[model samples]
Target: MIPITMIPRSEVQKIEKPGWVLVFGRRKTGKTYMLRHMVRHENYFFVTRGGLILEHEEQLLYPVFEERIKNLLLKDITVVVDEFQRLPEKFLDLLHYHSPDSRAKLILVGSSFSVARKLMERRSPLLGIVRPVKVGLIRPVDLIRGLFKLGISPELLLRIAPYIRDPWIMRFVNPGKFRRSDVIEAIRFNVPALIGEVFSEEDRVLTDRYELIIRALSLGNSTPGEVAGYISGFIERGLRSQDVKSYLANLLRMGIASRTQLAGRKRYLYSIESPLIDLFYYLDTKLGYYEIDVPMEELENLASVKEGTYFERFVVDLIASLYGARVQRSLDPEIDGILVKKGRIVAAIEVKMGDIAREEIIKFLERAPKEGEKIVVAREGPSLEGVSLLTHRDILSMAMNFEQRF
Candidate 1:
């Protein structure tokens, strides 16, 4: 067994608010771990699917467990319950009547995305009682800062750093033995299980249509038209572009997919959000259902080609979020992304995972948007004559600022 490294979750501070808290996020983003370690509670319970509750490490039936929770809350003691959705309606009503008035601070953590949203509906008994805390994947900057503590070099770190966002990868990333293959290995084992759990939590079943769309996005078909076309090739019943767009909305809300509008057009581009998820689906597509038996060398070669694209996206997302801005992809093939804040374009960014050539920089200079700031980000390269050059060193600065802000 491999030891895991623990990092502070920046969202924990939000749980410190005065009233009750409802913490929810996709599974494996570490919601349970954060609430267990970072919050103050007098009693902790884990509710099982069959209505059996494990309180203080002792299992009890619904009646006994409900009474214990009531007694603690009435005594003004804080309480935490993981998988609160699994409990009966009575448990929710118990809190609806008691949580706000009682001095007890209630921190409930749940993984079901569907149920979590239902709690905010008009008829919910606890609708206005608890503050909602959403936890997403490890922020790019926070993940970078944590990995830097392992003394990993900047260039090598960029190669596999995105995989570390999945909490399961924490087990595979040993300080001295870590390498790109180590991450790939971790993905090989975890991706299927992770996808299943996420879908299960969302109360979704992956039909053939869902798989086709996910695979299409993995292979770089980002537009709804492209996805519809791709799926048509695989099935007799074809979906319209508008239908594809509607389906992608659920994924965007769940944080599994992301979309960026075209710079000047109303159309959008879609892609998988998690790097591990992207790579896994890419491998599944390439192997044509032979993913389980793919050779390590073949898997490594396939993953290498997509690493740069994922890295470019990471830079785009990190930079855009720093300014509380939105990112748009341009129609020009040469331009990667544009960051916009309050309806004004602030920068046009070009990210190169490999060395930048003078001719390449010159080409970018000629084609990139002139009204906004011009910037090129690379691992290591000579300075451009007129553009801002950012490197992993600069990213470190951003990472530090990001941690402090959260």
Candidate 2:
């Protein structure tokens, strides 16, 4: 399996100090894989998930940890506790107590909501001492490079294949002899062809859930209520208490969908992650048609809105990931995106799917702090007053820029 953890593994090598480091990300995003890969040669213990060892008012889970510290006497030796949040709160105290003069490092990895709340919220033991590492999904670059490393042909890679959003589709298809049956089987099963290395249990669950969600999203149900109804109906024929919120939260954590709330109504639009899914939802399917297939022109028009929205979301995710630990995303009425660095608002972006007037741009720009940069992002060529206007192409280019910059 390809070790994508090499990126953080290289970064960890540069840290000589014996300080604590917390590696966190949504479940199935490869946090544990990175942690284990980084400390392979070092003395490390993999703690059981959702399990903890504790004593009265203290955590002795690391009972032999002190002994290992003296025995190793090495700067790079580290201990990793997978699913650290599943353990009781005392686990943090144990790590801190033994960290005074030892060269041993602590690597904590867990999923979203639980771990993020503990490490980032005020009054967290992990606060101020731990460095946060976030792992996102396989990027297009990573996919291309990973496939090449596996000796897959470039010609096969360039095929105008249906975007495979599901994992089960990889099971039956061979390298050559692609056919309509294969595509139908894939659509029926909802599995993608290529697997991002480092498959985990949580990853499988997410892949299945995303398959269901994308199907619902393809049926003209983009809003939370619509998606929720579809999923709830699909799962058990009825929606349970908090079923919508629970499934939506899980999908967001898995990077399958994203949420953005509109004005006056607290309702959010839960968009599918893949443009292929969007195309399947809008372009391929027709509603109550007179037995005629959608034409190229109709397909293109249907695709425009979904593609535009996907592009906007791509820009938001790019900025959020690249400038991570520096920026925060908010869905305010006027602002489509927000950037906060060092806990202060530094920039705001308004997303426009198509041509928009300068007056709307001004209203959106008003939401940003006067001291920070204000910009409008759109598909059409940009125009705005006193604010930087950037096109969809420019917005994507900015992601690479931030990748190189701070």
Candidate 3:
């Protein structure tokens, strides 16, 4: 297991008082990893869904409580329940029952939104007793800095860092500047050929062809029809509307795609978490489908297109890290970002991939009501009238480094 720090040790130190904490994040975001790391210093009781599930809720929970409080007569014991929502709802009362009497601490961790929603619903036993904390992707800088400390050569870091979306994964690889063909070759081997690995095997196929379709949409096919057409033509597979929607929905939840409506046209934006995925989707053919129609050379050439959407997703993730709760995506005129702090507009940003045009800047600015601060992000440094130009890197860095001003 690769250790990536999401919350600093100092932050955990501040939570000395006994209370309920609900830590959550998307799948594979290292929530349980950090929780286990934190509990090592204390006499902690770890309970999971599988351990507590039974037809009789109380019977399942009573044993857990008895075991947790067993032989601990010192300072308050900490109880960490991963996937707490999966436990019977009645278990919430059990948690509330022992805390005041034994002075024990409870930490509930859940990964699925469905679980979170059930726990947060009104009249739910866990409602109002939990403080929600969302864990997100590890920052690129933190991953890079940690890798350097771990004896990974910086020379390799700069080379492979840009390709990996998960900074923790990328910085660990620490290869040199990757050629498009080289990375695609890696994808051709890594993306599985079995549908079971990529999707539910009973229903899906692990066709690299589907991944290529997702890549095509991410690159620039914002509309559903257009994206569907691109995928069908590229793979020569007759695609359906439901297929597109289901696949896209999965991608959005994974933080790999985003969607919004503008003038009745729903635009789906790609959140490229891994540049390697991007390169694989764009360049590699052998990995996606059961069979290949495009020549290997042509596929490699296809991946060579300048990727702007990949950087856009990076910006979104960076901003999400900084302003997790304060940010909202705007629907009017398709602006890339809208930030509100303390009920006031703080910053509005839109990312343009290349060639900052004055008219385009004006069009984007018009989406905002001219409140607070506004900035435009682009690949090239351009001096535009009435607009501040920010490099893609600078914008991403600022989002990661943003501090709440309210």
By lDDT, who's the top model here? 1
Winning candidate number (TM-score): 1
The sequence of per-residue lDDT tens digits that candidate 1 reaches over residues 303-376 is 88898888788778778777667999986665788988888888888888877877777888888877788888
Model 3, C-alpha of 363: deviation from truth (Å): 9.5
Query: How many clashes in each structure?
Result: 0, 8, 12
Tell me the lDDT of model 2 at 355: 62
Q: In model 3, what is the error at residue 235, expressed in angstroms? A: 14
1 or 2, which is superior by TM-score? 1
Q: What's the lDDT for all of these models?
A: 0.79, 0.51, 0.54
**Backbone clashes in model 1:** 0
Q: After superposing candidate 2, which stretches have Cα over 4 Å from the reference?
A: 1-18, 26-70, 73-101, 110-133, 137-214, 217-222, 231-237, 240-242, 253-257, 263-267, 272-306, 317-387, 391-406
Q: Which scores higher on lDDT, 2 or 3? A: 3
Candidate 3 on 148-213: residue-level lDDT in tens? 444433334333434543433432332433344555554564543321332531224546655755
Compute each candidate's TM-score over C-alphas: 0.92, 0.48, 0.59
Residue-by-residue lDDT tens digits, candidate 2, 91-121: 5765555556656576666655446656776
RMSD of each: 2.2, 10.0, 7.4
Q: What is candidate 2's CA lDDT for residue 325?
A: 26
Candidate 3: C-alpha RMSD after superposition: 7.4
User: TM-score of model 2 relative to the true fold?
Assistant: 0.48
